[model samples]
Target: MEPTSDFDPARLARSLLRRSRQGALATLMPGTGDPYCSLVNLASHPDGSPILLISRLALHTKNILADGRVSLMLDERAEGDPLEGARVMLAGRAEEVTEAERELVRRRYLGAQPSAEVFVDFKDFSFFVIRPSGAHLVAGFGRIVDLKPGQFLTDLGGATPLLEAEAGAVAHMNEDHREAMNLYATRLLGADGADWICTGCDPDGMDMQAGRNALRLDFPERVTDGTGLRKMLVRLAGEARAKG
Candidate 1:
């Protein structure tokens, strides 16, 4: 799909907010004046800013309390061509959340990392919130969208033309095309009969169930007509056969 002149920061934020489970957090080590990094599971607040829960004793957590400056890099990790996926980096200031706000942060964090139940009991682990300074949103290969913290958070509720149309296109393809679906699954996705399911399709693309997750295909153009849809299916099949 061609890039839009106005990028939807909110849509991008929500996508990052929904799909990211792990991020690389970079924190400044106090005495040494160096940066330390660790992988952390994060969740976003309703306003779309990240809320980080950390064990007080964890090295990164300790560094944050001392210096407050932090950077987080989140990316989609599903198996695929890495160039096709999205990733974002958030620069923020971390602070130990206030006692009154702790419950909300705790709930959101635990919702994403249910297994944190085991470690939540540990006295050293607690919620630390990040108030972002800025964000860098990257969609697929070279599409980079940068925003100030306020703009990024505010845009989360705004609509994007492509995403809106893409949803509808995905619905149409999945509902109407079963033969092309099977061929794509068998040929491109390399999945056996029992493994495929038509998940959804929209003007911009289709999603098919492959193994335990769904594989997404973007349309060449805003595809509402049957001919455009057929061409998409054929393209997918050709790509699958070529790759195989």
Candidate 2:
């Protein structure tokens, strides 16, 4: 079915992928080919793909090793009826992170799941990225649609500088700009005030959290470098403060 011009399935799907802290990860059991599902913590890659860190000894991890194909379910976790909230089921291959990409992946994961730092380096644990093949988003009666990767995933083509500078920028915000973070949440994003911190930033948006509650702040325009990020943030801060 065609989505109305006003409803954006891609944007909704991206928000779910970015904001969800945990998801129902489904993998195929080796011999029986049965579907095995487990609750797994998650984070987003700079390009908006889901990231998972799991123990090699775990059944779901073992299933992934046998068959890389998997499906992940993420939702808004809204109040009241769960079915009334938006959700997306993403189909993809969950491939282990290559050595070259480990550090970047690790930083992004830990940013979202800070407690995982305790055992992130354990021999049994490894990182995997779900390179999405497609997604099925169920928003409501007329909002159901299948989105191709291009429709939902952020294009990182010219965003290398932002990706490279993400860790430093995130640290800088958390360390030196707590007030601004609070403003972004309370004023810009309309989130309740708290000690919100920047988890990660990509070309498309910034991710933030205060305890378990998460928020996504989309950039007014894409940023690809440290300077662009700085200016865009300053602009956002101004806009947020103006709301006062």
Candidate 3:
């Protein structure tokens, strides 16, 4: 079925990508080419693609090594009937992270899954990024739609400086401006949680988390560097405070 006129498949898909902490990963088994699915913990790349850290010894990892083609299923985990909740199936090629991007990927991944720090550097574990070619989203009746990569992925063009400064900015927010984080979550995003922390930031928005609960705070306008991010955040904080 075609999506409703007002339904935003792209936005819903992006939200699932950023907020989901775990998903079902499907890979092709070697030779026979059978499908092997496993539960995996994941984090988002800055552009909203899934980043996975899997050990070489795992069956799914071995299958991925032989064939990179994969699909990931992420859902909103909404209350009530599970099947009634929104979910997206992302089809892509999972490739090992390039050396030049390893540090950045690692930081973003660890930011969302801090417990991963315990074994993030293990020799057997490697980071992989799913470069999505397409996605299928199912929200409900009249909300099923297919999306091209461009439809759901965040555009990173001209945002190199923002990426370079992301780690430091996230650190500053989590460390020094936690009250602001709480304010953004409760006031602006209408989410309730304690000890909310900044997990990552991109040109499009900031990701915040409190334990298993996560929220995405889209910027009023895109920001491209540390200065722009700071200003956008300050403005958002003021707006959030004004709501009280």
Candidate 4:
């Protein structure tokens, strides 16, 4: 069947943004406009814009202050030629998040990296949001797409309740629902074996890890709460059982 209207390059680009925990950030230097690169941890706003916690004293923060235009590259690690794996380059403008959105952004950012709380309270620390203008995703050889942000990104406003509960859900599934997660990976995701453990879940998908291998599985439909999440898992389990 032909790809649906909703299925486009942006969807895959957004998938990269959803799965990546860390990415390379490049900013223009103050004096010469030279590109300065740094590693940054990533989180997302409800609109799928990138959110970063950076100290004002950091050079990259200075770059954002001087010039907002920036680019971020996120890629998956794979065996064999690294170029064979999927990766995305996102270009945008970065600016400090406003007061009204500060707390929620901070909460989401810190949820993924609780250790960041130690420095998050520091005087120089602040949150910045990167609203992408354009993106390019290379899904291995023979697949490439140029994406506009509007088409690819997910507006997760409906999933606020789910985002808030994600950390607890991760812990619970890894601890109590290992079998279900394993089935989700093997049966639904076509991943190898039952050793995968659930790491996190968002409205669109769930992430799992088997040692260094991270896998993301999209729901048959979007889910945005514990109830929906449970329903999806149960349905997936039933499907897996039926295949037995």
Question: lDDT by residue for model 2 over 1-244, one digit each (tens)?
Answer: 7777799888899989999999999999999999999999999999999999999999999999999999999989989999999999999999999999999999999989999999999999999999999999998878899999999999999888888898999999999999999999999988999999999999989999998999999997989998999999999999999999
lDDT of each: 0.64, 0.94, 0.94, 0.79
Residue 239 C-alpha lDDT in model 1: 73
Candidate 4 per-residue lDDT, tens place, 10-93, comes to 667766776677889999999999999999987766566778999898999999999999999988866888788888899999
Model 4's TM-score against the true structure: 0.77
Compute each candidate's TM-score over C-alphas: 0.59, 0.98, 0.98, 0.77
Q: Which stretches of candidate 4 lie over 4 Å from their true place?
A: 1-8, 114-118, 140-142, 157-176, 192-200, 209-213, 224-226, 241-244
In angstroms, the error of model 2 at 15 is 0.7
Tell me, what's the RMSD of every candidate?
10.2, 0.8, 0.8, 4.0
**What clash count does candidate 1 reach?**
10
Residue ranges of candidate 1 with Cα displaced over 4 Å: 1-3, 154-244
Q: In each prediction, how many residue pairs overlap at the backbone (N, C-alpha, C within less than 3 A)?
A: 10, 0, 0, 1
Least accurate stretch of 10 residues (summed lDDT) in model 3? 189-198
lDDT of 4: 0.79
For residues 60-154, could you state the per-residue lDDT of candidate 1 as single tens digits?
88888789999988777646776576778889888777887776566655645657788875888777777888888777544677768766552
> Of 2 and 4, which scores higher on TM-score?
2
Least well predicted 10-residue stretch by lDDT in candidate 1: 154-163
RMSD of 3: 0.8
